[model samples]
Target: MAQVLEFRLPDLGEGLTEAEIVRWLVAVGDVVEVDQPVVEVETAKAMVEVPCPYGGVVTARFGEEGTELPVGAPLLTVAVGAAATGTTTGNGSSGGMPSAPAAGTPGTAAESSGNVLVGYGTGAPAARRRRVRPTASAPAARVAPADEPAGAAEARVAADIADDTEQSGPVPVISPLVRRLAREYGLDLRQLSGSGPDGLILRADVEYAMRAAGAAAPAAPAAPAPAAVPGPAPRPPAVPTPTAAPVPAAPAAERIPLRGVRGTMADKLSRSRSEIPDATCWVDADATELLAARAAMNAAGGPKISLIALLARICVAALARHPELNATVDTAAREIVRLRDVHIGFAAQTGRGLVVPVVKDAHRRSAESLTGEFARLTEAAREGRLSPAELTGGTFTLNNYGVFGVDGSTPIINHPEAAMLGVGRIVPKPWVHQGELAVRQVVQLSLTFDHRVCDGGTAGGFLRYVADCVEQPAILLRSL
Candidate 1:
């Protein structure tokens, strides 16, 4: 008999709690290999293809396309092992089906891939499913009892496995959010009976425990407690009061949920605004020399150098001179953490939303290498294939909003990072050059720095250095 296993959505790291099923790769009755990509899911960070850890025939899928599911929610089920076979005679007589594989029987193929996400799947072989004995009055069915509803047998078997897990090992909790909730309330997960499939602890279980604990707590003192005791008392139920006649109901408005990449951007921007006291300093630069230099380099080069690559090179040089701006504020430690590596992130707007893909070890990369990396990351971002690792750990962000045909913006600092450099569109403008008014390629550059990290002097110097490089590309060669 095949051992049916339900696969839950694995934790797609970086603190993501849930994902929207963008697409499913398998259907009911389809055979799947271990570690095969089963579904495409869109999380807050990026689009990811979740793999199934079992090799088997798919039995069911839990959610439809565009349906959002939490980290621990079931994604699908697979029936592992070989199916029981039987022979029948033409005379209405039948040979009995072969007995199911015995528990831990040698030569019996294992069912799991042993590959899984964090906090999921034990490395040990899957627990052997108990064989059901037939009653005197009832005949043994091939897969399940005739009267049992679809999936009911699977549920029972899963629950049995869960019971064994709960008794012998760690609590069956897959979601970090659920664990965090329990931790916050000082609730013992082992003490509470899980309400999720296979006795898996869920966020709801933790929340219910918290509510129960709150209800069972002793009433607060008659008056406010001393300041040492934190948290305000629970408000008493409000008394009824006379009110005016009920107003007519308003029409429902179309409300877009802040979720996926959009939601992540909103949260990060909001957090950056709330936590960082930021200041912006901007200046217009004569980029005519920079453009000519890039054109010249490309004309003679093996690999063409991009304008942004040149700008990035200049930024890296500027940062080396002003390392204070290339640092982050550590509020808890009361210190400014200067990062040694320059993993520069550049803002890219995709079909999904705005994203910042970081170029790791940027300080060590050449202009040609930076151009190649930026191209690769931008392409990945457009295709929604950029991983969470590619999207984070940015020590500083270089945003060229000039692509949007804008002059400049007070770019918000990508949080935990100390600063952001925004570049506006480089356009032809008349400027005083060599004692004469000449039309030059000019661009506006803005530096947004966390006030806690550095003051205006450092920020201005960094911007000034970048502007000088753009005005005279030779200045950047000195650092090179």
Candidate 2:
């Protein structure tokens, strides 16, 4: 006998409430080790493999691929301390059939996992002094899949019937689908109890309630189509009025749910637009010297310095001069909070989507170190392996849209932070050098800052300093 434990989806931090099942790594009846990558899920932030804390045989899985499950929904159940064969046929059984353990016997080996959420771990099986009497169960046959007898329809019917039971308080819903169904039908779920284990209100319960409500209500007659208009004027399309019969829906288009990495981006960008009262200022910079400086550094370098790192160095130096821009707007307290440290965020586009990876304590690192860190983070972002910590806590952002061949962008502030600096393509352009026109490496730089954090003068000062450094790289030596 073994204890069967259900593992629910853990909170994949950064305010993500749900995730879509991309793939299942372990199948039913498969033996799994503790902390093994069990399923691949796409959250609004990143694609991650969720691990189970228990080491044993997987018994039942809850959702299918492409299904969206809310946090706290069951991922799978495992029978820990049980053999991978899934049956106790040889121990005190008749004719090699699986049998129940004697009551009050210490025969069942069960272990409880302490690390069930973010940190998964394993240890030796713990023996318990208290035990449960083995009930009449089929051991491995404890799982009821969607393809069971009478199929999902029967389960829905049974669950719906159970939904009619009165509850003491609020209904327990495991999936967001159930709540959406009820809202669409205007069903008062407080009056109905749930049909699932522990009174969980499932999608079936909502649909059943919808059908019941529709059946109990009186039907209305359909309105006749309007008469045709005179002459060449086209008659308005006949509007279908509400009736007892549900109108068949048009064939669905290929729809992808906005719930994972893409969804998080949408949310963050939206919030940044809504909460941060921002403004953008741009200027063209002569980058001939900056590019030349980079070449010199690389040619004479122990560790090659990247152009982005040199730009980062300029940004850190500019922030030191214009400290007002390196701050956040404290809306709740109605104050501008200037930060002491400079953690920079750089936008990196990957196959998954656009991600902003932060370089911690960027003001303290040299150009060589910044180059190495950016390379590491960019690789992590492309592979979808960046942790939430690596993706957040930036006081300012450096977005080099130049890599994409763009000339300029009014970059939205990465929220809570006050400002972002966008750099554009550096191409050869005729410019005044020593009062004479000459071809120079020209780049456009844009700074988007929160109005609550600073005024245009401060922002202009920061951008101008950045431009000065680009036009004459030796200006950075003064700060160094």
Candidate 3:
């Protein structure tokens, strides 16, 4: 007499209604241990491999790879019998036992029933369950320690084992897609903040951080000391930095279906544009003095700085004075969301997509620390390894299109942040200095604001203040 057991899919989290089977690690008639990885599934945000809860000889695979399954759908069946020799057969139609081969050779495997682990199982025809008993004792399934009752030391041990089994390092809650993206971009997953269901790191979270970091890099070069400003100034006309070629477009003009982070970004951007009416203001600032100041600072043994970081620091200092710019519009509540701390999100570009990673407490950090952190964040962002926390809680944003040789363009406000600043390339343009038309390093600045929260006066004033800071970088030291 053999006893039979069935395994169902477990919940992965984040209101996930369904999951597509990525691959099956085990086949029918294979002896599997409890907690062993048996299958991989792709959810809306990330891919995950699930472990088996029970130890038994696999009798059937409920569904094929790529099939979507619902929660509680039977995925596999095992016969628990006292004698190992008894053969069990399943009926091909809904509720029959799977057919078995002659004793000794591997048994014929059963087809998988398409069922999503979270929301709904496929409406495929059901398979009949064959009744069978087992002779060999099946080991009890392992459960997570965190889920266990209080005061159970055994649960703690189980939890430790579970953690080790699930994650390879400190941050084990990330999805497979995030891990893959992080690896491609050379990111360390543990360093990122998770924002997904149950605190899992999603793909969008990683991409956003990478983009922010990339946008902040070129600004550092604008900071070195006059003595350390290596190369002589360009003669008369300033030469533009060459831009990289745009990514090749897909041939045939075929429709590229959106999915994952790209799909989410499209939807979010669409919703933002539809819901939020935006207004922008522009200004031209002479960054020559600022560049000179940065060079002076760099000569003092400070970390190699960039114009972007200096700009970011100035923005944070200014936001402290003008809290209105750091607020979010609550249309439903008809209120404003004013944050206490200043976390400035910078736009970075990655191979997969664009990411905006936030630097927390920008006002408090030293120039050197911020510079190093900017490097770390951007490196992680470009590699697709940003965590969820890094993507959220941004009180403001900065977009640097200057590196691409563009003069300036209005950047869309990242929702919840009342305003965003766009910085363009610096060029030597003829400008009045002390009543003389002298050539100076001039740059265009654009400020895009959520009109509901910020008035034209407030927006323009903020840009003017930024211009003052950029024109006299020495003023930034006083603010700090």
Which candidate gets the maximum TM-score versus the true structure? Answer: 1
| Count of backbone collisions within predicted model 2 | 2
Q: TM-score of each candidate? A: 0.67, 0.66, 0.54
Tens digits of lDDT, candidate 3, 382-405:
755666567667889989989889
lDDT of 2: 0.73
* Winner on lDDT (1 vs 3): 1
lDDT winner among the candidates? 1
Candidate 2: C-alpha RMSD to true structure equals 16.2
- In model 2, the clashing pairs are 43-260, 44-260
Give the per-residue lDDT digits (tens) of candidate 2, residues 13-59: 98879889999998765556667899999877677899887765565
Name model 2 segments beyond 4 Å from true. 82-254
Model 3 TM-score, 2 decimals: 0.54
Output the TM-score of candidate 1.
0.67
Counted clashes in each candidate structure: 0, 2, 69
Error of 3 at 11 (Å): 6.5
Q: Rate the local accuracy (lDDT) of all candidates.
A: 0.76, 0.73, 0.65
